[model samples]
Target: MHDPATLELLRAGKLEILGRIVEASNATLLCSVELDGVTGHCVYKPVQGERPLWDFPDGTLAGREVASYLVSAASGWGVVPPTVLRDGPFGSGMVQLWIDTPAASISDDEDSGAGSGSAAGSGSAAHREHVEQVSDLVELCPPGAVPQGWMPILRAQDYSGEMVVLAHADHPGLRRMAVLDVVLNNADRKGGHVLAGLDGGVYGVDHGICLHSEPKLRTVLWGWAGEPIGDEAVEMLSKLASLLEGELADQLDEHLTIAEVQALRTRVRRLLATRVMPEPSGMRPAIPWPAF
Candidate 1:
């Protein structure tokens, strides 16, 4: 829902904010947004003053998330809807529909450690609670277990509720989007990021860090890391490649570069090749301090 007057209202903060939502990891602003036509109450993340986060400029995280959602949609994946990106009293910020799903673990096994798909950095009680809650929301596969990076459910925020565990990463469409998240280097796939919609459709949210050529492919859904890319996945990527110059391409072109798309394809190629897992080149072997 893109409305000029409504956007103006939001810009002025004239649109009354309901309550004080929790601060996000990246943005410094106290984030609570208005939901015009999108859906439920949304969480708006505004950029802070001069010195925001060290990685990007103020409002950069929200803008990047908006851009990531756009690209993911172009790839034919279902991600959270980023309605507006305005530069008003809040400077440059984005507004997205706030979803309501409990913080639960989608992992089949016990919560051994933090998930790999976590973007930014994983230490929030919200994320941990999400993993824990998902344990009961959805059913799991008795024989299969998800790898750390390839968490089946990706959420943006954290809540306290029953978690919806999946039946092994069996759904083709779901896994396809998971692959896209990895290639795009989506960092914040907290349990709340993966929303269950009206018609049993799962939606991804919080993608401020996406469409980069850098090897920032951090995620909790790594179950397939050591697995070979099946033929079906190859076909999907092929279709995505073909659409690179079509409608999807147009949308992605605005936020990403040609090289970035190529890199996405490259990731697909690697996944489809053999069973070689991607190793992190992080300076520290493990998640550094300040992660907890």
Candidate 2:
């Protein structure tokens, strides 16, 4: 759980490198950070660890990560965890308080869209079993099916080479996250990024590619496309709109360009005026690669 005092500690903590996340593509590390007698575990990603992207400025991913946290706070929904920018052992980086979760209750079959192998050969028997456990809870509708409670996210092949459509249950927090994503223009919202928190809440992470001035809002949460924005979310967006002119804008100015911040405010206004969930803009791929 991320309380205000804990967040302040994370912002101004002394970090000790515990270990490196070898599996991560970039320079990601696990650290024990302490401040004012408060100690916590955090994931640290240094600026030097970032893989260079053609579209984004070098060493700016850490800033974008902090920006995402600000947007999550502005939305009045604690979707993104508490993140802060600080100098670490590696260098200046982004530090996020780690969230512990039970073995993920959701399926994360990383077969690259099927045509791969059997579940046993796929090396994810546990995940396969979990998918089966939820078979009754989730109705696998056919393509083009838009049930009242389900929204299609992607299509994948099952073990038997059968087509299986993956959809998410319509939830309130998820809807708010979708609105937050639109405002941040998040370029990467993978299924694996959504974690079932130990606090019994859903949270999103790995927002290093968000808040660019460009329209890079690719995600897997398009099930609510064209749906009307709920009143609660609209009110939150209105409040966020006002904050963007003052506190939010000031914090973002430290990380993003003036144009990018302006673009973010523009998105807030547009979402509030429309009062509807956004549809795929068709400007780019709607789903991020390795969606889950």
Candidate 3:
């Protein structure tokens, strides 16, 4: 239902500014967009609103956002929300449908509930007994300590002065998103950028710094690093690699250089060949700044 409306509104919506996203480092605005008498909320990031980046050329973030969406769709994981590049009141920009993030109960215990998996840096265990109850959802952070699926993201002191770890669920959808990031060469995938929709959908946004020719993948979804890529994800990667040679490649050319487009194809093929999740190259920090 969201796919068609998202495309329609983004391409022809009459945009009306609702407010600015003050927390965003770039020029991000919230607006009400109307198209063919239908109204919806969306995020607008204008080209003129972009800040200069030493590596990325100026005023190209909006296009990058659209490119990211294309890659996401090609992967067939739908990790990214619907995004399109169009002209707005502020000028040319990327307009994306807004995802409402209402809270949901992950567990019966209120204390075990988390918010978008960004509040704490680490996935700390409140009690060892709790791990046994939700063992299906989590694994040990340290080998031989907790289990296999657990990857610690943050560590903090509890009120009793005991250190606790905060970790994210290493679920299938998230693992797919991680693979999606690798193929796109996403440079900035902070925790907060991962949104939870009211309908139990997970989305990754703020993809303006993706698809660089250089290997600049920085993300918080490194929990599965070095793990063998699952059969389903491997199949998806294979599908995207084939699609890139055709329509996807042509579409990307409008937003990226020939070299960058080729690089994207190369990355996908390499992942398919390797058949494993990649470890940090150590060229840069594996995690993005401000982690959340």
What lDDT, from 0 to 1, does candidate 2 have?
A: 0.76
lDDT of each: 0.47, 0.76, 0.75
Across 1-292, the per-residue lDDT of candidate 2 in tens digits comes to 4467868768787877867878666788877667766566678999999999999899899999999998897777989988999888878999997654454221223221111122122336665554343332223456667466777777877668888786766766677778889989999887777765534456888899998888999888887889888888888888998998898899999999999999999998998899888888777899887666
Candidate 2 lDDT trough over 10 residues, lowest sum: 111-120
- lDDT of candidate 3 vs native? 0.75
How many clashes does each candidate structure show, in the order listed?
44, 0, 13
Q: Which candidate is the best by TM-score?
A: 2
In candidate 3, stretches whose alpha carbon ends up further than 4 angstroms from where it belongs are: 103-150, 154-166
Candidate 1 lDDT at 34 equals: 34
Query: Would you estimate the TM-scores of all the predictions?
Result: 0.57, 0.82, 0.81
Cα lDDT tens digits, model 1, 81-124, are 53456653455666654433333222212111111112112446
- What count of clashes does model 1 give? 44
Cα error, candidate 3, residue 213 (Å): 0.5
